[model samples]
Target: MPSSSGRPNNNLLRALSAQDYELIRPHVRCETKAAGELLYRPGDHVGSAYFPCGPSLVSYEVTDGDGRNVETVLVGREGAVGGIVSLGFLPAYCLIVVKFDGPFVRVPIVNIQSAKDRSPSFKNMFARYADCLMAQMFQSTACNAIHSIEQRTAKWIAAAMDRTGENLVPLTHDQLAAMLGVGRSYTSRVLQAFRQEGILTTRRGALIVDDPDKLRLRACRCNEAVKEHFDIVLRGVYPEPDDAAVA
Candidate 1:
């Protein structure tokens, strides 16, 4: 059973042996995170690490001068966001946004570093998860550059479903547009097309995916490739369904 700290809700924490979890458990604090919360901003000092629990989702945002952030990676209960590989006094290079609402376990980076130093297995696990993160970032870049918006949209939906474990996505077109770094009008049209084909329904600032299989079929192969890499590197530390939940 998980203690009051909520550490066991996250896959990475669960992957640790009983002894390893005890090393970090004392340092972890569970906190509620609302949707749209900016956990880390560009150039901000790293304060702590967050492990999203359950349906909580976070996205890494890469921004340019236009001021709109393009989401590069989507994180779920399967991983931790921010200050993972860093040790001390590091400034965040990318923004971290919470895309879903739930509890998160935060541990001070200093404590995390101390835990890593003492536990060789803990260090190795984090190192492998870091590799998985980098792989997701690279694949997202390639997918955005080469795939159509429609395909990417399907992939995003499929990925979200995997994390949230629900077909109803609580997001508006404008929210998705900002995440995808596209125009609201364009996203609306694309969503409308999706509705027309009986793939999904968009209304009242949320989307209901009635046909996940069809949506997955429409999505680009990028998410699958990322999952394959996770299979090799982190295995169960990543989301592995007989289906897909993202990387």
Candidate 2:
């Protein structure tokens, strides 16, 4: 069984051996994060690292001169929210916000650095994870730029479902617009079309995917591209045990 107390309920943590788990166990702290919560603002000081225990989505956003912000990347259970610290940057313009309610384990940055200094293997794992996240971010940029709204939405739904192990995503249309960098009206239209096609079931403030296979088929090539990279590069990070939860 997984150990109790200051620990991360993440793939990386599960992958660790007894000795490796013990190295960083003492410094972890749990936190409850709700939907729409701002995990970190543009210039907030980096104090700790969050490893999501349940499902919590993180969006990277930038504000334009007109005060309108655009999302650049979405992070969920597959990885940690703060990877910029690895590059030695303290405050970045990218905003980290939670889109799903969950419990997360936070380890102080200082403690993480101390563990890195003491363990070469732990450092190697983090370095690899950082690289994987960068690759995913680049893929997301291309997908948003070239993919159709319907295709992109399908991809988003598929990714979220994979992470949460739940079909129901409790998000409002406005939130979806912010995520896709599209207008509210457009998001509503796209969702309406999907519902008509029996691809998704939308309620007052949530979307339930009724047909995942159809959704995948409708998604653009960008979805498959990012997933392929995640599979090849991240490998053991997301385990596929032939179970229905991720299947």
Candidate 3:
């Protein structure tokens, strides 16, 4: 009995043609989730795909043997999490957690499959999104291997800011360290350096980006590389920050 009204704020859903969107419109429902809420864990069957709206964000994290959860990719309003191109109720491979508290559009996997089966364009669009997502994962792997902690930190902040359209990131030093798969001290040093450069400031549980352009200058090209792929594969689907929000 979940109700949905008005146009979806998600970039992926907004990119769909009127005809294609209507196919899944009736089946989609709206829900709000709090930050740090776990939507899916490893081995859980993914029955629905959640499309974040506005500044909502989700992340895929994998736990290592040492019990550290390392983030792989962050999905915001630009795309979706869970069962994008999968068939039936497939088991999730990683932990999917909500990073920002906001509204999300939920569509049953069956409805998505039905829409894709009926429309080649719908299938192609989702398929392209899957490709773009994979490219992001690949670029993140490369960045982790090649970039310095400082560069990675700046890149992560920039990417988050772009999707949320906000200069303030609601993340703690511990959380950022976990996402980077490094010790807190490493991330702290990077953040301290950024603070010294007047690029950002840290609060009790958040970091505020003071100068986005300066932060971008310190970041590696991994974000840009992934964004370029997204542009080529799904133009206008990637989220861009509003000028006033970032400024």
Candidate 4:
């Protein structure tokens, strides 16, 4: 949800200079989204940009013709999905899916482009955010190629917890398989092992972290690397949920 100050809780928006914030403030509209919802699909024009708030998590995935998708990037309060680098409404190259239930502030692409055109600082901020997003994409590719599924699973679980700011993340093995681009049985097996090791516990469709420090040890280092890059490119734009948002 947006804060009472009328500014979005999203780090990028909160980081905006007062002058730049006002330029786009009137156009921002906050809306709620459910898990498993698709914000945009490949071939669909991106009509708006979404900045997720606490409890909101979006995934950018490369979709195949067969309708399967593998996540390339994760966006939360720290970033936006859709219409960031584009000058106007354009077909999305990847599908954007919300994996958590929460609110997001969306602004039309035209407004975003207009805001950028009118404010040099705004344009520069968008450019830096886009670069930081690209860094996530690159790191994700390498992490998938080099890391074991156990480690990668831990990474994404930790990421989801970070984004949602919850000790309990509502996700099922099937959902995670799609993101990890693995077989459902494989994901189930991995998850079962985690439970056996007392890393986490699951009930219904949610996962509760038991020993986060141990879970962090099982994760690949890509998350830290991506966070460092974001801190460098868009200082304070990456949500430090571990400290600021986590319960």
Candidate 5:
């Protein structure tokens, strides 16, 4: 459900002043989307911006020459995806997919552009979010190059958990492998090791985090780095697990 103020449960929207929020509130629509929904493909013109609400999640993926779709960044309630900083319709550079099933707030790009044109502060806020988004991509690239697969796996799970505020991540081994740009066998081995250590357990189509602290212990600092950047750039916009659920 939407909030009492008729806003979606998106932190970026929540961060906007009442006056600025009203500029676009009347134009926004909230809807639930299932996992595996494709929001954008490379070269496609971006028509709308999506803000994941509640436990919903979205990812930017790039297909490598080997035909592997590697995840670049995950956006949850804390951010928006598509033509975020662009002044007008622009071609998407990556494949954007829904990673979790939940409610999302969709705003046509034209409405957003109209709102931005009316309020410089609103535009600045999104520009800062875009900076934070870029920081995540930068850190992810460095992590993939320097961290071991085991560490990366833990970090990925932790990142997802933080965003959804849930222990169970709805992802299959094959899905995880594709996101990590690795083979299913390699992902299975890392998961097996984590299971043996009592950190997490794998279900038919999900991974349950048995102990978040232990999982964090096994993870690299990439997630933390991104969170820190978000804090500095968009202080109260970053979602925390304890944040109240919108109804």
Candidate 6:
């Protein structure tokens, strides 16, 4: 299992069967993931796959008519990024943008795919994770279309909190607006509403959740669904809760 440094509070790696983990051990490389960093963009070759030791925000950007770009999904520690198109030579439809600062375990794409072929148990576990990713992406689409900005913002905040395991989320209104696909003014208004409700506290450029449950209540179903899926899918695959807790 990976040490508790710059890693997300997840049980997946630790929960892995020893034999399965050993197969991929040699290929797991640690790297820094800072906020506002871009991992890969459209047309960039998928060289590595990253699993967060901490929370990260990976967004998929798609250009619409008139060339306006919008985010499709926000990937955090709940799922590994850059694995979908890694084997398929499909051009990227989205960009992986880091939302929080932390460390992540990176494996070369080829190595990861090769490990999948070499280890059946590991392949099954990774495939399950892929399903969770699909669920999140689907939920995001629904949340974007049907939920209010305040509700969606709450969902986003909750997701970040889960990934980073911190209340102080370092994100700006402009960035949030971009991720949420809303006007900057609209994001500001929604944030003010959240602040008034005591669900969040906003400073100059960052936000801190004052009450997690309150945010959960305000969030769309997507927030809960994603967490539930992760819990269900990653169940026996990660270490026990007592064991995976970060130091």
Question: What lDDT score belongs to each candidate, Candidate 1 first?
Answer: 0.84, 0.71, 0.89, 0.86, 0.89, 0.71
Query: What global local distance difference test value does model 1 have?
Result: 0.84
Best prediction by lDDT: 5
Ten contiguous residues with the weakest lDDT in model 4: 238-247
Listed per candidate, the RMSD to the true structure in angstroms reads: 2.8, 3.0, 2.8, 1.7, 1.4, 3.3
Model 4 Cα lDDT, one tens digit per residue, 11-56: 8888899999999888999899998899998798888999897668
**What is the overall TM-score of model 5 with all chains considered together?**
0.96
What does candidate 5's lDDT look like per residue over 1-247, in tens digits?
Answer: 5766567878898899999999998888888889999999999999999999888999999988877799999999899999997877899999999999899988999999998899999899988998999999999999999999989999999888888888889999999988988889998999999999999898899999998999999999998898889999999887775564453
TM-score, per-candidate, Cα-based: 0.93, 0.89, 0.95, 0.95, 0.96, 0.86
Between candidates 1 and 6, the one scoring higher on TM-score is 1
Q: lDDT: which is higher, 2 or 6? A: 2
**Model 2 over residues 1-247: C-alpha lDDT tens digits?**
1234333556666665667667878876777888778878888877777776545566777777777767776666566776423744376556777778777777777777777778887777777677777777788888887888888888887777766667788888988887788899988998898899998998888999898888888887764666566677666665232212221
Pairs with backbone N, CA or C atoms under 3 Å apart (clashes), candidate 5 = none
- Which residue pairs show backbone clashes in model 1? none
How much does candidate 3 score in TM-score? 0.95
- Write one digit per residue (lDDT tens) for candidate 3, span 22-48: 999999888999999999999998989
In terms of lDDT, which candidate is stronger, 2 or 3? 3
Model 3, residue pairs in steric clash: none
What is the Cα-based TM-score of model 4?
0.95
Structure candidate 2, residue pairs in collision: none
* Per-residue error (Å), model 5, residue 15: 0.7
> How displaced is residue 21 in candidate 5, in Å?
0.4
